[model samples]
Target: MQLQQWAEQAASQQDWSTALQLIELAAWQEPDNPQILCRWGDWLAAAGQPEEAIAAYQAVLEFQPGCPQSIAAWAAVLNEQGQFAEAIALLDQASEQTADLWHQRAVALQSLGDWPQALTSCDSALQLDPTAAESQFLRSKLRLGLGDWSQGSPEYESRLLVFSELRDRLPSFGCPLWQGEDLTNKTLLIWGEQGYGDQIQFVRYLSVLHDRWPETPLLLLVSEPLVDLFRQLAIANLQVATQFTFETESAYDFHLPLLSLPERLGATADVIPLAQGYLPRSLQSEIRLQANPRQLQVGFVWQAGETSDRRYQWRQASKSVPLEQFLQLRLQVNHCQFWSLQVGPARQSLLQNWDWADCDLADRMHSFADTAAVLNQMDLLITVDTAIAHLAGALEIPTWLLLPKFADWRWSLTGSETPWYQSMRLYRQAIAGDWRSVFEQLQQDLNSRPY
Candidate 1:
């Protein structure tokens, strides 16, 4: 009992190491106690030791079968580990359903690409507790993922209410959210959100907003890195701002996040505007590189950028393929010259061997535009779901995007194509964490491609 109390105190202070140690000792002392075992599982999961957490949960289920709390916690970890089907089976073992259990079932089903069933489960959860913001946010994603713009768009606002980071970072403006208010004699300031890829993907809405309300001045705020790339949008009334925040209330009449425009713009999967791409024809900045005519020019990015958000790290890792796997594709494919477009700390993987890439462009790329200039010189760009992938697709370059089995909603369930970019083709992993098959298929496609 004292050890459990000490563990709870340590956990509250975010001392996961001490908490885990204390919790493990407490569980060992009271080996038959289901409460202590469940607490140990929770601490293990919080410590990022998922497999150990599963074992702890399994120990609880061994004696106290059909425990709802243990089953829900176990399923949540399974979902995080990309074991969606197993999570669903485990959820069914619960003696009784709670809002949390229903929510876990929906999460597992959603990960398995069963949007309809997932939505039903989400509705059940919401019925149990309408105030469950996480369930509401997930339902919003499911609705939008199914291309239901009308219902999903309104529910999407829950993101602001639910996600603490997003809510905190949202620039506090005195102006109300623009929504669908008339644009005549008004100004709208739209800011970026999420990651570089999200900002790039959603910036197209600015072009739509500009054309719809050309008389109204539009301000687009983004991180400094994307300022040059977005300028290529070429809207007369649009001004891209690099500033982090707004100082005065008078910058614009109404302010909204760039993503908020999709609802007003009436865009769904059936009607993603500028699918051919909105970025201008290759800027004169395009380099005319001289290379061997016998070989095909190929650029590859094997990893996505890192994030401190522990909850999203698994998704981020799912989007990345090991550099060695891509390098091995070079040996199987014929007459294709490969270059590395990977940057950030993961770029260090290239230094492991000199023969991996013909050229590493990490140092040469200073901005998104610089990457575009390089893409202009490439015959094809193959990459994971990164900002570079979005940039390449936006530039209307021939791009092959490698995706995990459980890809982002934008990529949809299973297909070689997406509505977002006509020039981009998708190659998805048939199973989670299996890049070998993806690369094997890619190699065959490359070998069979007519020169």
Candidate 2:
């Protein structure tokens, strides 16, 4: 078997020792082979040996100079290690060596928050390959960040081709593109995309469409995670459907992605629906005991997901704050009740710092519904860009959404508010993974609030 295939199998089976051995053998057999070297670097990086990966990639330049893959991979490692300047330099070199290299360079620059430079790259990328899905997707992201929705909206459609598997599963073997025209009296099927927060952000467009075309039949094709929450809307002629039962007939006249609504509605910050207190319901007495009213009821969520079984999985999980950060904030804010809205058990130990006086709601709530019941009484939700923020936004409750600097396009970079949720406020890190500023801002914002 080829070393690459063997290594892939080893990694798949979590036989990292075998994978490492195979990569080393491959590297020795072809020391000057850039592809082999780059693969070794990938394995090293995936194994949490980024420093070694950087060396492996750097060695590739000795034989095959200006190799884009090597340059891009090395730059990525550098970026991960916070060496943004070095990473940008490498990406720039790679871009100049090839046509449309600016796209990769632009992404590197975007990671560094150089939007103007990123824009220049996007222009170059579009010039070289206007039809390229990635270039268009990145352009859309940069445009959204630049507050240029007119251009970004169309670019967002690039995802349909970029993630072809998702497109393949759709009724049509293409993105459910819409012109954002009238849908009154017509049954419009809208499906969610990407993450839960995405669904929440996009659903705001539903309310907008419904109001504009009150006569339209809105059939929302939602995920199992959100059916119960969306069912609460139950607007006349509005139906929530999950699980594609083939027996169910195709019933909609038009369709669009949940994320596409912003483009359709021409949403900007000034026109956002910013209402307050979305999910208004009292919890049972037993549930109520889990929250303390004297302390400002603050809900916390850290960590995103743990799907990958590799060294990098640890880093993906690190997107959340260590438990001490939450504990410190709970104490610093003073007179605040702390509760966890986190979904998984892997990081529950982080709450050990909080006194028993603070309730740990992580285990008590079974799903979003149980969590929503607790959130209904919350004074505030301080969470990363996860589903709970979406839930809070959907209910029109006051929520502070902490976003990574490159944030989802739906948030739009120019504002403290999102058009999707009137009561939702945004706290963005100045740089990706830099949460200190966001936390500081959250503390200040909470202090200024009436609640």
Candidate 3:
């Protein structure tokens, strides 16, 4: 059979082993064929044999020097093997040989966490082929990582158009942004986006916005559970809209995603204004009465909703743990009530164990609002870097956010505190995915305190 025919049959059958074998047979017949070598190398990499793939691709480069495809394939395998610098060097050579080389270089640099260089490559790729779909998509993602939102937002919108649901979900605003000036006589709809934690974090800016434009009709659209709590915010002209049940006719003059407030505020590493506390008055009043007479009331959220790590497939596959680690910490606290704000599957299992330190909130709670109410009542919240952490931060409740070693950038690095929340204290893992050390330090901190 023809090499192409064999390759096509193997691929169509979903037999990676057979495809690899066929590619090797072809390469053996035409040992100096750069094309065959590159194809075989790619199949090897796809079959999770990056080391072998790199060797095959290198053989191609030996015969035909400056082979861009082989160079790129070698770089990609090196990247997969965690040899970022070597991969980047290969990409540099590949990039010089082709007009679309920058696109390949960007992929290599992104893997190395070199966002700035990757952005430059993305720019070069766009300049080379402005209409290219992959160039447009990657450019947007790299720009977001670089924290360049001025251009990022428009690019994001453009990229989102590729997804029918995302495109449809976007409101027809007639404009890309709100000036905050035209709000004098119009209703401004401020709604949530992204994860629950994102919604909670950005919601704090709503109050700042309300103070900035008191005369504008502020209709805050949030998930149903947050409605009752947000209604009590009681800013002048503040109105609440929950879920899909709200009556509306897109008559608003402007709309903004709540997450965009950070961009509008020009929030930066040094400028995170940590306002001491900002929980709603009604909720505060309720929590104040429930505060224990003798102990430092620290609310605890051990596990984030399972959805938090769903996007990181490799991480999910390798290292995921339950609240058993949390139970160990609970034993160290004598007077503290270890409340479980952990939602979803983990919560049920935790309740079944019935290991909570006589804490009754787990029995009474059913939704996020209940969790929010409990947070308001507590003096401090000890939680994983989850939605509860964002909620506590937005409410300006004193919260100690626990983070994994390789944390998301929103938390930033080299800090014991968050700029977005004055009341938040950060406890991070010293090593990647090492929660035991983090938990040990937290335990010591709890022990040192007058519990």
Candidate 4:
């Protein structure tokens, strides 16, 4: 094979060193080749060198203006870096619009919170290629965000087919999937298939399922850490387990993902079942935090945990806040004790800033049950978009959830109140990647609280 072909093969196999060496030689051999330059730019971007990627794209376009492939690639990187309008302008400069260019434009528009324009662009993409999985999935998220659950819920199934780092890690059952039909003589196995927050949020559907199909055996299999927290649901005719053996597959007539319950149950935003006080109230945990009668206890989680796990590549973006922001909030208050429940990257900074000795409860937390015990005693929980937010909400604890400009679909498009958690209020970023406004709102809200 040619040098360029060898570089492409190495890049596909994730051998960055081999790929870089081969691509460098190939670029040296064919100095004017736009294809090689664009591919090299993509590789650079993937390898976390966006500036170099942009330079490589600039080289290709400088040599050959209106190069569609190079323009699209460069625009994508620009949009990912929060340059929405610039990305769009670059895409507009293209002589002809391909599906990729339209998709890139749609993404940029979506980032700008122009959902209507983004939907239009996405429709244009779907028109060009009716079977595009990525666009279809994006459409689902857009529709759901707009509260059009009927269309979005059905299209959301496209996620299972998409190529994500989390896709292959999801559990697959040999039996057929349940489709909201009669299960008179059948057993349905509901497995938690996503993050801890997802499992916590969706577990509310168990009681509803049991209530509907009184005789049908419903088994819920969640992660081991959650078994203690979820078993307290104590719903009638419900069985909660942490494991599923191959032999058990023979017993289950059908299997369904926990998140899929929404679609199967036809749950719209307006009519969310078991929205509050659904998950076991106060979650009977053996652990509890020590609280002073005179001081208001506050627990906070600044970052999502276990981000290095390849399955949660999405969390690597860091929805966390700077430690200074929380400290600033701390300065404005008096007699309100702050406990850092933050895990992952922010844990070290929190320990250095505060005496971990005072917040030994955070260190002792190992399971969702342990976190629940801390949250149970907390007067209020201030957190980013993490599983801890869901856990606190599950316990009906007062929580202020700070969200990014484009948060997940569960929070919906625009609302202070969420249907999923009555005690939780959302504080979304008005400007993308800017948390200043969010913190300002938080300060006002916290100051008004009667401590």
Candidate 5:
């Protein structure tokens, strides 16, 4: 096979290292080939070498100015780096227009909070290619932001296509995906998807599903860490398990992803399953509270799980506050006992100046169940956008969710309240990346409340 052919084969199989090697060999043989350079650039971008990829794309532009492929790929890398304006400019300069180019432009515009324009660009792309999953998913978020849940929830199903990693993990049950079908005597397998926060947020749909089919047996498959916590639902016909066994397959007649339950059940912001609390009281060991008159117990989680992906890394940074800020807040409040509900390497932040009154449950709290138990003892919970926030909300604990300027779509824009969790209150940064104002507001609110 020719060097270029071999490289294409390797790329098809997702062997980035081998693909890069073959592309390098092909480039060496045909030193001035713009196509080879573009191939090299694409592979480099896929491997997360943005700088090297840009260099290769620039080389292609030098040989063949305004090359559509190089321009689009280069713009994509810039978008990944949060240079939305520059990416938009580059896409506009492209000589050719394609569905992908418009989609990339829409993504950049969306990042800049240009929702109307982003929606327009996304529609243009979707009109050209209706099967473009990423564009469809982006449109769904835009629609949701506008509170058009009727259309948004249905379009959101494209997530299975846009996030290939998530789609690949979905098990094939050899049965049709369960819509709102008759299940008087049937069994349904409800499997988990996305992050812990998403699972917690959507699990409320199960109660509705149970009510609709009171006689139907519902088998829930969740991550191991959540299995114990979800069991608290205690639905009479529902069984919770970490994984699905082949022996149990015959028991279920149909299956559905947990997140998909919303669309299937026609859940809207106004008509979401409103409940005081969904999770049952956790029976796990709880941290002992000190006997002090006029003392308030508070729990806080500052950081999310560590990630190397640039997208998630940015999210983690945006949601997290420096430990110094939390300490300052603790100092400002009187007779308040702060508890560390943060886990992973982020928990080390608490060791800087250990206070005896502040209970540290980092070592003891293992799963969502353990965290829920600790939250049960607290008067209030303060956290960033993480699973703990969702858990507290699910448990009907008073929770203050600190949000960045460009918050997640679920929280919506311009709101102190959320429809998902009635007990949860949102505190957003007036300016992007500014946590001081949020903290100040939180401090003021705490000061006004009776201990």
Candidate 6:
């Protein structure tokens, strides 16, 4: 017990190595203790050792059969390993019914594209504990996946409570959140949230906001990287800033996150304000294309930006494809000239060997503005689920987006098209984490197309 207390203290202090060591020692001292074994499993899972964590959970379940905590924790690790069916089966066997177990079941069902079942599980969980923000958030995503945006958009507010880090980073203003209130002659500040792709996708709503409140001044607080790209909107009475420190002298009246615009305007999948492109076309760059003029000028992005957050790690891994896999497309397709639209350190590593594409823009694209300018020259854009895909979709470029089997809610389930972007075509993986099948289908489609 003393060792476990010391381990908790060490963990709270962020000394994970010492905390893990302490937990291991405590487990050794009390081998048959389910509580100790569960704690050891949690530490192992947090340490990115899912296999070891699964073993620990299995040990706990052996001693205490059908333990709700062990079952829920084990199911979560199984889901992370992409064993959704197995996770769901284990969740079904849990003797104790708890909100957490229901939530775990909901997640596993959602991953398997069982939206109706997932929503039912979410409802069951929420009925038990209405304040379960994570379940509510998942419910919102399930609703969106099922194209019930009227319900989903309103429930989406639970995200702030669900993702605590996002809530912590949010700039709080004493002003009330804008909820379709009259903004006549009043200033409204709309701030960006989440990833760069989210900012780019939702920025189109600014035009809708501007149109509604033509007389009202609109202040957009966006990320530093996107500041330059958003500046080109040039909406009357609109201002863009990278940061906002709420002060008495501030020019805004009401503040809202960019995503909340959908709920405020009562937007659904059917009415996603500005279904076509919204961004102004960038002036063509002086950079010359080295590709054959007769062939299709296609740009491709293979990976998303790297992140340390465990919540995002699995999504990033599933979405990203190896550079070697894209090289196969180069070898198979001869009608199109491929251009590397990839940015960041990953691009640098891919460009080291240097013999795949006609031109590389890794050194040139520093911001979204630069990438937008380059994307303008391409006839077609091929990319994974990344910011570049959203950028291309926003620009109204003909974009082919490659998606994993369990893709984001925005792409929805069982579709080759999204209502968000008219020019974008989705190519989804037939099996989870199988990029080879996606690429093979993509090659066939490219060959059959009249480009």
Pairs of residues clashing in candidate 5: none
Candidate 5: segments with Cα more than 4 A from true spot: 12-14, 169-171, 245-250, 282-293, 306-312, 352-358
Residue 347 alpha-carbon offset, candidate 1, angstroms: 2.1
- TM-score of candidate 5 against the unseen true structure: 0.92
lDDT of 2 by residue, 1-451 (tens): 3986898789888677788899889888877778888888887887878888889988998877788878877876775565667777777666344424566577667766678788887788778666777778878877876777778776788877766556675666233456776675567778778766667656656777777888887778877767766666636667776755423565666677777777777776445553443343443334664555566777877666654444124334435665656766776787677777777764457655446424667766765566667788788888776778878876655787776665555665556876667777877777666778777777777677664
TM-score of each: 0.87, 0.80, 0.67, 0.91, 0.92, 0.93
Candidate 6 structure lDDT? 0.85
Clashing pairs in 6: none
The local lDDT score (0 to 100) that residue 59 gets in candidate 2 is: 95
Worst 10 residues of 5 by lDDT: 284-293
Give stretches of model 4 more than 4 Å off: 165-172, 243-250, 305-318, 354-357
lDDT (Cα, tens digit) per residue for candidate 1, span 219-314: 888888888888778788777768744334346888898777887777666778787887875665745455567889889999988876555676
Report how far residue 217 has shifted in candidate 2, in Å. 2.9
Q: Judged by TM-score relative to the true structure, which candidate is superior, 5 or 6?
A: 6
Error of 1 at 300 (Å): 0.8
At residue 168, what lDDT does model 1 achieve?
80
In model 2, the runs with Cα more than 4 Å from the true position are 1-30, 39-52, 80-82, 92-95, 171-186, 245-250, 264-270, 273-287, 290-293, 305-319, 351-358, 403-420, 428-451
- Candidate 1, residue 175: lDDT: 78
Candidate 5 residue 274 C-alpha distance from true site, Å: 2.4
Error of 1 at 94 (Å): 1.5
**Tens-digit lDDT string for candidate 6 (391-412):** 9988899999988898888998
Candidate 5 residue lDDT tens string, 345-389: 877667756573256677767788888888888999999999999
Candidate 3, residues 75-144, lDDT tens digits: the string is 6566555466786777766534443466667766665456677778878877877765555666766665
Candidate 3: list runs displaced more than 4 Å.
1-165, 171-181, 243-250, 264-270, 284-295, 307-322, 357-363
